[model samples]
Target: MAAFTATCCGRALKMVVFLARLVFQLLAVYAVVLLLVYVCQRSLQYFPDKNHPGDPKESAAPSMREVELRTEDGLTLNAWFAAPVKRDGKIVVMYHGNAGHIGHRAVKAQHFIDKGMGVLLVEYRGFGGNIGSPSEQGLYKDGRAALSFLEKQEYANAQLVIYGESIGSGVATQMAYEIQPRYLILEAPFSSAAAVAKKRYFFLPVDWLMKDRFDNIDKIGGIKTNLLIVHGDEDSVIPIELAQMLYEQANHPKEFITINGGHHNDLYDHHAGHVVTEWLEKQIAAEEPAVKPEE
Candidate 1:
């Protein structure tokens, strides 16, 4: 009987070891699959040329001078600078959203130029025919590089206005901490990238695992510029309530405009450009003009 019991115990131990090894293999496979999915989603924007300019007529507006910028990582970023017939040392550096490149922002940029302000439309690291992939850190570097490039030009002394739309808001907020633009504008922004990810992938525990935080809510309060937030009440992607939450966190001298009947992609549909231009004009007009010494 003792010999029989010993054999049974050995058999149980072997079974436990086999089950452990099988579980380990399953986990290893799961990890690799998860990694592959992440890499694919992160790189989906760079593959194929889907972001090209769909409307050629967008170029019919006043042409903007093309500007090329280099990030700290040596990746080239493309930009378009539309200066007034004569610049008065005021520039608006606009950052495009995650979906399309700067080509989609031509109408918005023209409105700024029409308002007597130089507009700089910057492409993120991987978007708009730029080299490398788009990440939170890369975008911050790209935005700073654009600002540095602008600082070297004739409008170096111009008041800098930073504008960001959609995912670009996070980049804009990070740059605000670094460069402290004279004015900051965010359109259809989210509270945080993680927050949006959580909403989209509620089935999985992605909020904690996501390497890119893009936490704009944390960075917005530190910005020392006049903040202007515009959002569409009918936004289907990011709720308008979150936009209000972000606006409320801002300090004094901040404004919020709700684009009537607008959606996430149609910010310009309900007079967004006109509303933004009008607000910018009033803000710029309110500031005390810089005193220049007569030669």
Candidate 2:
């Protein structure tokens, strides 16, 4: 009977050991996965060349002139300036989404030009074959540099309109907070990069793991400039809810426009340019002093 009891105890001890080994193996695999995610997190966040053609020259329009901007951090950034056919003394400094170079946004520039507003399509450091890598701070520097270049051109602060698309919204928010442009527009903006990352990578601890926390929500409250947020109700990338949340947090003189049946990349197809141009005209009219009847 004692031998039987001893054998049973030995079997229980072996089972416990086996369970322990299994747990350790599982943990090791999980740790390796975490390591891999950490190493490649930035790559997932930024896609500078996504859908880009082989030649950067293809992105330029006939009226688009190449401009060189020098960032405060000593990076030479490339930009395309599409002057308005009829100058309205207003310029839109466009900060494009994460993917692709300025060429991807040339059409948007054309839209601005057609509206009699010039466009300064600033390319981030790592984008558009520019020098230096991209990071949250690096993008901010790039934004400031673009603004500085514009300032040197003697455009009044009231004539400068800041426009951000997708991830560029974060950069634009930071700039608007600091520089306080006459008008600020964000297209399909997220609340924060961390929030989006958490949703997309629900299984992982993305809040702690994300490096580029473009916390636009925290900064939007400080932007006192006139704001316009254009979002697609059917956007799957940066959901419309995020844009709504941002609009709610923004100060007065803010407008939120939702395009029906518009997805993430096709808001332009849904008359986004018309909406923007109309809003811009309203703002410009508001700035003009009331015309008094001639005596």
Candidate 3:
């Protein structure tokens, strides 16, 4: 009986040691993964194509002029200004998504130009062959620079609109909170970068691992400007629920447009321009007092 007991005790000790080693190995792997994610997190967040081979001039409208904006941090960014054909005194400062250069947005700019609204396609740092890397703060500065450039052109705050697309929504929300533009439009905005990351990487601790947490939900409530949010029902990249969460947090005088069967990149393709232009015209007309009848 004593020998049998001894054998059983030895077997239990071996099993415990083996289990402990396995646990340690797993922990080591997890730690390495976390480190890698931390080091290269921005790589996954920003996908910039420095050499945008396509010439924007070809597709640009006649009034579209290529301009360069200098951020407060001394970074010279690229931009394209598509002036209104009629100079309606309204301008849209567009902040694009993570991918693609400013030229890719020429069509969208043309849409606004056709509606008689000037469009400023602002490129973020590290995008469109611009200097400096793109971070949350860098993007905020870039947005501010774009707005300041337009302000210098004599566009009043009420005459300017801020448009945020995809990841650019965070930058737009921040700018809206600070400047309170007359109109703020967010397309397919996530509640927060961390929230979206958590949804995709539920197995990992994305909340703690993410460095550039563009927490738009936390900032949207502070934006008292007239807000318009556009999200597609079929968006797979940033879920519509995230945009809904943001809409719920926004202030009054806000509008939400749901595009049926629209994905992340095609919300505009689904007649979003019509919806947006109609709302913009209404807002502009509402601001303008009715002319009195001639006596």
Candidate 2, residues 144-206: lDDT per residue as tens digits?
999898878776677789999999999999999998887999999999988888778889988
Residue 187 lDDT in candidate 3: 88
Cα error, residue 21 of model 2, in Å, equals 1.9
Best by lDDT: 3
lDDT of 1 by residue, 114-206 (tens): 767778888776676666777778788888888878777755533788888888888888888777777899999988877777777675467
Better of 2 and 3 by TM-score: 3
How well is each residue in 172-276 modelled by candidate 3, as lDDT tens digits? 999998998889999899999999899888888998788889999998888888889999999999999999999999999999999999999987789888888
- Model 3 scores worst on lDDT over the 10 consecutive residues at 52-61
Candidate 2 wrongly placed segments (more than 4 Å) = 1-9, 50-61, 84-88
Best model per TM-score: 3
Model 2 residue 136 lDDT? 93
Scored by lDDT, model 1 comes in at: 0.79
For each candidate, give its TM-score against the true structure.
Answer: 0.81, 0.92, 0.95
Which pairs clash inside model 3? none
Assess each prediction's global lDDT (C-alpha) against the native: 0.79, 0.86, 0.87
Which of candidates 2 and 3 reaches a greater lDDT?
3
For residue 175, give model 3's deviation from the true position in Å.
Answer: 0.7
Candidate 1 residue 158 Cα shift, in angstroms, is: 5.7
